[model samples]
Target: MSPTHTDVPMAPAELDPCGMPDHPDCGIRDVLDRVGDKWSVLVVVELASGPRRFGELQRAVDGISQRMLTLTVRRLERDGLVTRTVYPTVPAQVDYRLTDTGASLTHLVKALADWSLRHREAIAASRHLYDQTHPDHDIR
Candidate 1:
């Protein structure tokens, strides 16, 4: 039998891992890739409370380098998930906030955060077991 259009082998949906047929062109993967990094998630959560200036955000998301923060913000801005506003002043103030779409993703992000909190002990245990097994390997 010949392959029907629906039966033809198609590529895995690049955008979403869910592979739903309806969202053929969804940019969800690109969006996830952009925001999947740790610093991005931290920035999003920090901005969820309210808009923050660059330096303030840098301070709030501890351990993030200036370069990484700048890169993460730029990626979020380019993906339309975050908004950046600049004010003309002697100090040249700039602020970042989440877009509506980004706001919608907060539930998912929080769910992940909740899971992380719940599993921290288990994760630590697993890390301890692995470290014992691999001796000399630093799994930080």
Candidate 2:
């Protein structure tokens, strides 16, 4: 038997837990890892409306520390999902806006957010029951 592709030996398109192809160097996984974090989702949604400065994003993304925001945008920039621009001003203003790829991802993000909202109460109840049944451990 031979591997399907030899680019990354022993790594071929295989289903992951999420049903996405599980393989080393899989671009899908690479993209998901970059934008699948909660911070990434929130950041992308916040910028979906338009570009925002660092402080604006910090405020828009509740509970996100400035440091985490910095890291998130940096990752997005590296992924080509967002653009970070600096302008010469009194304080050298910085702004972030979604790239075409990032804009394309907003619909997916919104769908996931909507699903979470729709199932919030059910999920809460499930969590409560699970916690009661497994008091000795944290499922999270």
Please list the Cα RMSD from the true structure of every candidate, rounded to 1 decimal place. 11.7, 10.1
Measured on C-alpha atoms, candidate 1 has an lDDT of 0.82
TM, every model? 0.75, 0.80
In the range 89-119, model 2's lDDT, one tens digit per residue, is 9979999999999999999999999999999
Model 1, 101: alpha-carbon shift in Å? 1.0
Worst 10 residues of 1 by lDDT: 1-10
True lDDT of residue 95, candidate 2 = 97
Per-residue CA lDDT of model 1 for 1-140, tens digit only, reads: 23342232333534554355887666766666767888889999998888999999999999998777877887778667899999999788899999998888788889999999999999999998999999988658
| Global fold similarity of model 2 (TM-score) | 0.80
Total backbone clashes of candidate 1, pairs 3 or more residues apart or in separate chains? 1
Q: Work out how many backbone clashes candidate 2 has.
A: 0
lDDT against the true structure, per candidate, is 0.82, 0.84
Give the runs in model 1 whose Cα sits over 4 Å from its true position.
1-28, 136-140
Error of 2 at 70 (Å): 0.9
